[model samples]
Target: MITEDSEFLKGVKEDDNSSFKAIYEKYSRDLFVYAYNIIKEKTVCEDIIQEVFISLWAKRKTTTITSLKPYLFQAVKFQIFNHFRNNKFSREDLTRLNIIDVSMNVSQKLEYSELDQIIRDHVAKLPKRCRHIFVLSRYHHKSNKEIADELEISVQAVKNQISKALAFLRNNLQLEEVAFISLILLQ
Candidate 1:
């Protein structure tokens, strides 16, 4: 199916200015609102959003985006984080704007969301039984005993299924140990 996001991306790749404008009109307000919430500065938020759009346009020819919404949101978040990291703001200044903790939270959220998408995509490619067992264990927070009982399988079978799933994901994702551990902890 040719989704709206795919159409927009196609237009962008073809250098359609109107398509870019449509994207800006559709997402700018939400992005601004999100940025303003974190930065608490209208001018700074506006600048960040503008820069995000400019960067998106500049990279349109090279970037392959399956989903534009999350990509844009993540870009805004990275820009915000960069603003905090690059500027020599004092603790008091950061605290005064209530930005320090919020920025950290946004950073974690971006990581988690990206990892979650990767995990979901890999899970979808798993074998049917392995996918079911993995989803039950990770998404439903079910124990091996519970999943085995529900599926009329042995706990050893459940363990094997989960192991297979993890092996596939680990091989495909090639995630760092810390990142993979954090993902498991989050689930």
Candidate 2:
């Protein structure tokens, strides 16, 4: 018998709504819980799961996904980290709250949420090309060559854009910014 995830994935590949529903029914809770562990916001967790599924559907044609579970998990991890980074959560707050462990006090959790909003606010202000390059590299995990080819630019140009964006963020944001930006670019 075909497994549910594989079947739903097959249906999703064919752009079937029922199959998409099945996918949501099967993974939504688990994915949301995982996201909540990272983001610690019930509302944001729902949004993240929705965004992840929407992204999966949008990229279905070109995504070459073999395993849905791992891909979904990867998406959640990135989204959560992005939530944290975009918020520019202060190091002192991060340390005080022990965000690495989700078993924190409620007040600390609220603080984390506020910080995430701030980070998102600043990231939204980035220049057009810089923002696109950052999003493509960070969110879509595109390589320099792939980004260059897609944008009709030289690989060196792609590299320069990434370097410039990273430098800008590093200068303006905290050290945590370096980790995710590097993780996205170097991956």
Best by lDDT: 1
Residue range 1-187, candidate 2, lDDT tens digits:
6777787888888989998888788778978976675567899999989999899999877887776776886777666656775687876645323233233479856755665554555556778887787777765655577789999998888878778876665567665543322233232
The list of candidate 1 runs beyond 4 A from truth reads: 90-187
- Model 2 off-target regions past 4 Å? 92-187
Error of 1 at 71 (Å): 0.0
In order, the Cα lDDT scores of the candidates are 0.74, 0.68
Clashing pairs for predicted structure model 2, backbone only: 86-119, 86-120, 87-116, 87-119
Model 1: which residue pairs collide?
Answer: none
RMSD of 1: 12.3
Give lDDT: candidate 1, residue 125.
100
Clashes of each: 0, 4
The positional error of residue 183 in candidate 2, measured at the CA in angstroms, is 12
